[model samples]
Target: MTRPSLLAAIAIASLSTITTGAFAADQLVVASFGGAYTASQSKAFIEPYMAEKGAKVLTADYNGGLAELRSQVQSGNGAWDVIDLELQDALRACDDGLIEKIDASQLAPAADGTAAADDFLPGTLMDCGVGTIMWSNIIAYDKTKFQNGGPKTIADFFDLEKFPGKRGLSNKPNVNLEWALMADGVPNDKIYETLATEEGLNRAFAKLDTIKKDAVFWGAHAQAPQLLADGEVVMTAAANGRIYDAISKEHKPFEIVWDGQIWNLDVWAISKASKNKDAALDFVKFSTTGPRLADVTKYISYGPVRKSSQGLVPEAIRTNLPTYETNFKTSLANDLEFWADHQDEINQRWATWMAK
Candidate 1:
């Protein structure tokens, strides 16, 4: 099927679940990054919510950014009711009034009676966003390409002489900058502190320049895995869950290297211009419950935000999660506040560097 027609078919199928005939007024539109992540949300959150509320829920996919949400809010015609955003974008959007502020009291408490605020991990809840999952961007490579183990550390990713091939990196400056700094010998704890300065920014760009000619920049999550599979790049930086999905479901030989993995939260925020404010808020409350958050692990490798949800995750999947102790030992939590403060300046710098 043609791409447009296929999307139309998916939309029709989603609307059909409402059991109501051709009613568009009551529908809720949710926006998220596409691929395995959205598929997991569809199973663990959207489908169940639709079944219980008998509400039509349409899904829209986007490469993560604040531009679309910003445009919708400015024009007062938001097409999305709820959106999944990276931590930095969520913070920026909430501060800019592009999304509605959520009352913590309105959220459902854990099954054990703990308050929602106390149950969620520290820094997960924000004024306008409810934390959904904790995920990571890690180095993933085809195991077959490396006979004697693989690039084991963040530094090794930049060592083209040791492991020669094209490298795949996200086109954005967020994680790439962090990885570049780490690979250049900046300690994890001191990453943002160092990056906040002019010299540090130059250091990161200089490190990245080493691989610029051989780098394959990908804009979407799915492209990372496809690049490795097609041998377009020997190794790529990818979301941990995407690599996990490819390995476990498709039996791909990709392996994830946890060293210097940059982890962050994905939050669900309501667009300020949403037509269905109350319904959208209700959906957020429903989907973030302890049980619902835990249920998502059945579909993806992301860790749930609620403490109560941790024990509920199956043992098999728990070890694969970004929160798993062994995997997290060398991980760095992406500093959302730092990015919120410096994103514009850094992005401008990144664009200039790319042009060169």
Candidate 2:
């Protein structure tokens, strides 16, 4: 996929704006995390697949569809052909037989100029669900507060006396719990293992208690960046992409401390009863292939799923991309299994935590 071809792909995608008329009334309704990000996905893969397979693609929201999926499965009328879910959501969906097992061999092979899925980070690409985007809950700080130097680690987040201010924290246990445990003396390497223990969760909450009344619990992605940019909070947990956007716009001394950041793995899974399974699979294959993925990341600033996408970027810009192995080395992968098993209990605790 060269620059010209990339443009051609976008043009084809733009024309696909036509109402998937009767040529193929069949539709593959997808439940996903919808945003401008999905637009990039539509241009890069969905439209291409629609044109080639003569199929209709419908979009739906994921949070609203879980109950619908449960009901549809009971009725034996599953409507979704594919789902774009967070890592843990995909795992839970797979367990409930809401999705089908994917065969990697059926996907497009990486050859010559075409970027292939194999070029992705090992273990991130899967037989069924593949990670589509990379995001991290990194340490975002006010540059003006520390113009000469800024807070750099989980320890700094805990160090109120040295670099203290109102902090923004995710209400969820995934990243916040990990950050909490990290604050309580858990090594980055041992963060997840610590989280598996009763003491670890308690310890994490206890650490958070130190700043509880002062912490602003952002309920959505948009909130954290807005809070930081508006000085609603000085240092806090933030998504890397949003943090970057704020830094670029605010021109404030905002900087991200990647150390001990929690990585969010957004993954894609295909429906078991998809009408266009082959083409759906092709879409997945095309979406995650390194070159197209690289292009998507270059445009969106979200980390690419492929390991080699980092190479596609210029040396200077590579630092901003999460494809770099060093970035992966520093960030902790979310404990999807832990979250899957304890989501109910954790939700209760989070609710209690929030009530205070």
Candidate 3:
């Protein structure tokens, strides 16, 4: 009630308002498929996302992104605020009721996500998750091992006589199975179709057996570049970004054969239970916007999901990625939908085959 006490109270109130205002400007938590993407998000997505909304951003892991959502929904105790889900996981999330339908009205009618306006990536922006980063499954090899410099087609991956060395592969069956079938002379376009048949599965296993002794099945992303750098394996099928990191940083004599590269994406989705759903959605919107996307794309080596940001990225960083333009003459686009349906069956066969 005294004048000095009143003055002190006013000063305290002013300081609280300033602090809260600054904090409110930008602050959101995102669980994304981590690794290079996380670092890139900090540069391309998070920092800018924060600046745009006047909020500070935090990042976490949810590889394949929606796995955490699936686990949370199954356990009935969700923790993530927002996630960078993969397409298959996004589909599963919807079926499992882990995600709330995105409120389209929250976004501008002309916002990049509005498909009727033809702004979003092909078939990515419905009520499901949005694509944020895109990369490819590429054939990376040590140039020093081959006289002709290496094989071009997927079949060459099986030609141990011509390009003899230990090999590496992703532990997952989704992409590697296609490479297996391709090495067995299955057409790239018919890869998933053939794999659906028992004969195709047999042939893939047969091809895998040829290199089983020399193969190092990589269960983690970091293992590929490390295996490549330390000479643990001579050549392998690897994600383009991981190989890029190895060669780009250490100047490792490596190259990617894009002949049968598989395009992959990381999708962003909001948790159904997130009290900060609106704030999370705002974070997604801000992260995918032009300025932040371009900045992040440079270091991450993943292509921007938003078409608007493509022009903003520097030419050097832009050329390193597999863009739609680079995909023109090459074979790409694996059957993600098919994998979603048969991952369990294929994974079983993969385990059996690897055991042999």
Candidate 4:
């Protein structure tokens, strides 16, 4: 009850109010593909937004899929405020009313004052989502295996006789099927169209049968790089970012073949059930700007979705990006619509094919 004690308590209360009042009222929960990918996003997007808006930002990880988002939305009490989603998943979630629709005008425009619609790469902007990065699923080989030369084309990856080693492939069928058809002599632009036909499906599966015996399948992103570094498989069909991390961080002897690379965009989506929907959309707008998008490439090799961000990417790593002009010319743009429509049936066929 002393004056000194009462004064000390008053001072502490004032300090608490000053600190807490600096931040926004709502706590934002963001979900993403974890590890380095999320790490990059945290540095580029979350940290700065929290600092500027004084918002409390929390993060969670998920294997890329709509199931978790659906669970949250359908339950009507979703914990996540925002999520990073694959384009196809984003499209489906928007259609299913699992995520909030985005207005492209609400997004920040280019540094040059170009409209957001004009600044973002083709197919990067969508009705319900805005893409942040363009990533590739491509082939990578252990440099130690082929000192003189390695896989120069997608077909080289399939030629077991020439490469003469076990191949590592993702368990998912999307990229694998695309690669199979391209290697089987289908043109890069014609891959998805060909895949839509029964004959094309048969051809892709038949081509896969060639390497099925020696192929070592991986279920996770990290496992692909580890498979190459540990020499379990001489080469892998892997995300370019994983391969880049292996070579740059782990110092693994890996080489990427950009030819016939299947590339797609990863987008940010707001949860329809989120209590902090406006704050979530605010974060999306802040993150998708050119400079913010460019900052991400410092941690990962994925290309920024904004065309302007390309100029900001470091020169040394420019060629490594999926959207790099020279590399993109030979690469395949993954058809998000095709996968969105056919994912279930294709996945079922993939399971049956794998079971045999």
Candidate maximizing lDDT: 1
Q: Candidate 4, residue 271: CA error in Å?
A: 1.0
Write down the lDDT of every candidate, Cα atoms only.
Answer: 0.86, 0.66, 0.67, 0.82
Question: Which tens-of-lDDT digit does each residue in 1-356 have in candidate 3?
Answer: 01111112211011110001112343467776566657767777677666656666688764363566667766766577778776667767865778756633343332344532144455445355655777778888888767676777777787888878888887778787778887777776777778888888777777788888888988767677778767887788777777787677668898777777777666677777665666777676666554556676667677775666677888878778877466424655656667766888888877877676
- 171 in model 2: Cα distance from truth in Å? 1.7
Provide TM-scores for the models.
0.91, 0.78, 0.83, 0.89
lDDT of 1 by residue, 1-356 (tens): 01111112211011110111233337999999999999999999999999988888889999998899999999999799999998778877866988887777678889989989889877777777888999999999888988887899999899999888899999889989889999999998888888999999889999999999999999999899999999999999999999999998889999999998888889999998888887888789889999999999998899999999999999999999998989989898777667767988999988888888
Clashes of each: 0, 1, 9, 0
The candidate with the higher lDDT, 3 or 4, is 4
Rank by TM-score, descending?
1, 4, 3, 2
Candidate 2 global lDDT: 0.66
lDDT, candidate 4, at 259: 87
Clashing pairs in 2: 143-253
Sliding window of 10 residues with minimal summed lDDT for model 2: 10-19
Off by over 4 Å in 4: 1-25
